[model samples]
Target: MDFYHRAGLILDALDNKKGSVKGLCMAEAKKGRKAGEGARFLKVVVEVLKYRPHIQHLLTATKLLAQEPTLFVPPSSTAAVASALKSGSAASANKALKTPRKHVKAAPSPLSLASVMVHDLLFAKRGLTLPKEHKVRKKLEKYQPALEKENEREKRRRKVATNEGLQIALPEKVASSLEGIGKGKKRAHDADRFAEEGAGSDGAPGEIRWMRVNTLRWTVEAAVEWLEKCGWEMFEDVQEMLAAAQSKPKVFALDAHIEPLLALPAAVSLPTISAYQDGRLLAQDKASCMPAWVLLMPALLDAEERAEAGLLYVDDEDEDEEKKAAGGDAKGKGKAKSKGIRVLDATAAPGNKTTMAAALVATEGINGRVVACERDQGRFKVLKDMLKRADAKNVQPMNVDFLSLKPDDAKLKNVTHLLVDPSCSGSGIPSRLDHLLPSAPEDEQLARIRALSNFQLAIVSHALRFSGAQRVVYSTCSIWEQEDEGVVMRVLAKKEFREAGWRLAPRDEVMPTWERRGRVEACGGDETIADSLVRCLPEDGTNGFFVACFVKDETAAPIAAPALPAAAAAADEGEEDAALEPLEDEDVTEDASAPAVSAQPVKKGGKAAKKAKSTASQAARKAKDEVLGLASAPAAAKESGDAEVKAPAKKGGEGGKKLSKKQMYLLKKEELKRKKEAAQE
Candidate 1:
């Protein structure tokens, strides 16, 4: 792309140029080519010398040649030049060149390159330009008073409203539990979008979710019917889900920070908004969405494995199908719904993609599962809370570490899809997010990064072992070589992983902003994932992210070492389920502030500047080896196909058998069955 790179390519081709490279370089320097090309040319010659015979000794032969720059001639022309020079004659290079031009190549003329500044830009000193304060100061002066007035008015309203007796409320866990989730720092917010305090704490300036509703012959009505039949009652108004689905799904972030985003063709139903809903259509960052398109292409999969997902984002075109193979519905609905397809969220937690995969599963009204897992306790709780609220039925939450999970341990069989959103530095994410975390020392951040990298490697390694996982989306919110391209490179370097079965993926599109990358070995033809990995940056109005896809070969070498011990298998499977013991303490409510909060005020434009911010916590651990391994038992239900209303197996206690809890926060499936039975009576 630049002279430095071009010169490198050119100099590399000079090894076969016959004339001694050093002599030629010296001659070129004398002709004014500069030391840059000379050094490059000599390096190429030395590489050639390593492989060729007498060429390595040519330097010895030309020991005195540089003293007289004219001595540097083509290898074939060298003998004649020497003879003429020894005979006391001024032998010009033209005499040797005129002998018989029999197809020999000419050495590059060094003089023409005198003006080249090969590495100029790579070493340039530059800074970004910003608007001067005076310009904006004058423009914004008019709005200052109005802004002050609004704050004054807010105080008066608060005095009249709450001064008498009113209290604000926090979410489910308590106001105190929201400690780290709130903002601690601020980014330069646009005046029109954010309040003075910034996008956090005081105002819920909530983040937005982009969704795309599926419209296959089955509109959301049909899908909802299927869900209703199966027992899922999302609290959002049914009409609202339908309206939201049909409407162009854009973002709905809270005030404080504004950003424009698009909802994919994903159907955001009522279950997506409530506290127990999948409020935001959690999916991949807009930029990283490419790798799922490219590297881990499931489109190349066989018909059965592709299953319903094979028809992502397609609108029916009866006119095109007869003339062209437009990808729409393949087989009849009945036939298509019988197949078993699955996807795994390898390191899923805080459940973004886990929930998205759930939406896709719900759309099919068929048997598909998303196995989502988290490695840490705090994040694992986040996953639990998210799944509970979103009513994500298709996903099976596992609190197992990815590295500790084996292909078989992933009891979710018949998986055709796998998504590994491993950990990495937040380079791909906006500085706005990292700003949320408190400032730590430089060494601490590095240590955190290294720790995250190790987990990332383990997740990918284990994911690759799953035999049923044909299509995988390996992603990270990082843009480092060690994590981005480097992880891919490490997988490539493993001779067995490469030879056993793996290849670069193909892509249907490339984001222009990231088209210039993928110049490393891991990129597979300079492509990110086998050259198909996609990278997203915050600057692009998308989450900073990286995504790569991989296709597994069924016939490739197996990736197993030994079977897991029986005891370990049981422990791993039952551990998390054993963790949710009920708190023995009494519920602690704010003693004095419960009055106004209990009223559920329907005020107008109330979430403005949730500015007077404050930040909140709880912990419980279960003990092992209880009596009879049963905490308690009872409460049974009717079994229907794959939809069993089996409650979470209670903790084993004095008698060893586990019991069930009250259905206050029941899973969708069980709640539905219970409701149906109650209605009939």
Candidate 2:
């Protein structure tokens, strides 16, 4: 007998008793001689359960036929079995009975037979069934008319329920009415209610096969045309395409939100598509594309501004010269080209954003360069391979911890933009099966989330410190407030960040067209910053994602220059060289004993000595500020020049009236008193 018929027999054998399907199946298998047949029997039983929930009712009906098989067994089957029994030879009987008699019917109850026939017919309707030549075929054929009538009745009932917006209740009224046969009325009512609510509900939004045309290889028009030639049909309306996807294999449509993105029917296998194999198409999530899109905003804005100023156009030769001047090779052939914008991609593994940034810059003819860094060696290798395959010429991959790189590293000096998509809990990604299921204990998951948020904060903090970094896009594939808005708020609250003039870029200024903004509650009720964030939830036809753009506040007041400590200034000035060089593997801590330095001179000296002393003091202060991250080295150097030029002039009374002899005498007396107090200490 085929597996389905065998499964029906097992259902009949359960005899309406409440028992574990798996346990009963396993017990039946042990009693069978052929192990493979037993395994196949279990497989069929599981499949049956997946589609049908009222197993008890199904079994109850089937059990009655087991006790009275004559009313249900096919006439031909009954005749054949009887004929074999009548043949007096014992050898003939043994041979006929060699196969398991569990499914073979000498007699059948009408109820059990009807139930089995109905199940097999339903499976057949759903395109799940055995071959036409199987032994169960004869029985199914005998019940064909009754089965067809019942099927038509069901179709009408479904039509009525759909039109009425009511849930499809149990098909057999007798199953609900009969006592001790199935669930009570209350349970049935709940099931019906649930079914009604879910009738039109598209379970999980169907997975969309999103493919982005690699503009580096092919334009969107060309890619679409190629797909058309390959037997794909493009729909103008995404809804129309999605509707058609339910019935067709290769229906495709342009993505409504993201450009150069096309959504293909979920049934269409991208790997089989020729363009994907050739790297002309990228299978990327729409949400995953947000980071690159946001990262490119600054460059695009700059281009627009330059265009408005009529300075956007540059000849090839002029561009090459500019590139050379900005540290590119004479031939402009190196990865570190200077004519385009520079981007730092922290945590850039698998190279999606890196390649996307390169593609965007290339499409705009901006000659942009991307510094893609990955900490994990394995992921770094993958990133390199992806970049190479994507034909991303503008990216320079680095296998180093982004946190380990100093904010003032020479390699990061030209990076005008930063893209940070750090490690996150990935709780928002439904595609990860583990994320779909219940995770570890609540405490454990919370701990992991906390650790991830801390790491995320550290990475973004480091990225913001890059000298001259005007824009940064921080993104995570986490839906948790801790990883998204929490990290943003914490980083923005840091004194270092405020000093550096960091603030969230307004959302309207970044991705103005995107409708879904971040959760304001997640940002601790800060609506201004919340509006600037972008969030993508799964129901929005994208993976859960959070992206926030930060930009340097050009209009904010410049941080005041830090003064040198008195101890630092008076320490022979010979210790300056040692302090300038950071000790290897040593943590630098502030010397609490060093009194805060003031800009004014405190000691009496000749004009020349005072000037020299002021100059040394400024240099020492600048060095200390750089080491302590109070100021960038380049900014400190510039400030040092201004202080030197202004210091002597103020003392010489060049810009203002000089103090009188009596006023100078009083200043000298006060200076002496302060000196006496310092000596007493």
| The candidate that achieves the highest lDDT relative to the unseen native structure | 2
lDDT of 1 by residue, 59-103 (tens): 223332233333223344434444554665445555654666464
lDDT of 2 at 109: 33
Error (Å) of candidate 1 at residue 377 is: 4.1
Model 2, 304-342: lDDT tens per residue?
Answer: 676566544333456667677878755534333235678
| TM-score (all chains, Cα) for each model | 0.38, 0.51
* Colliding pairs, model 2: 65-109, 68-108, 68-109, 69-107, 69-108, 70-107, 70-108
Work out how many backbone clashes candidate 2 has: 7
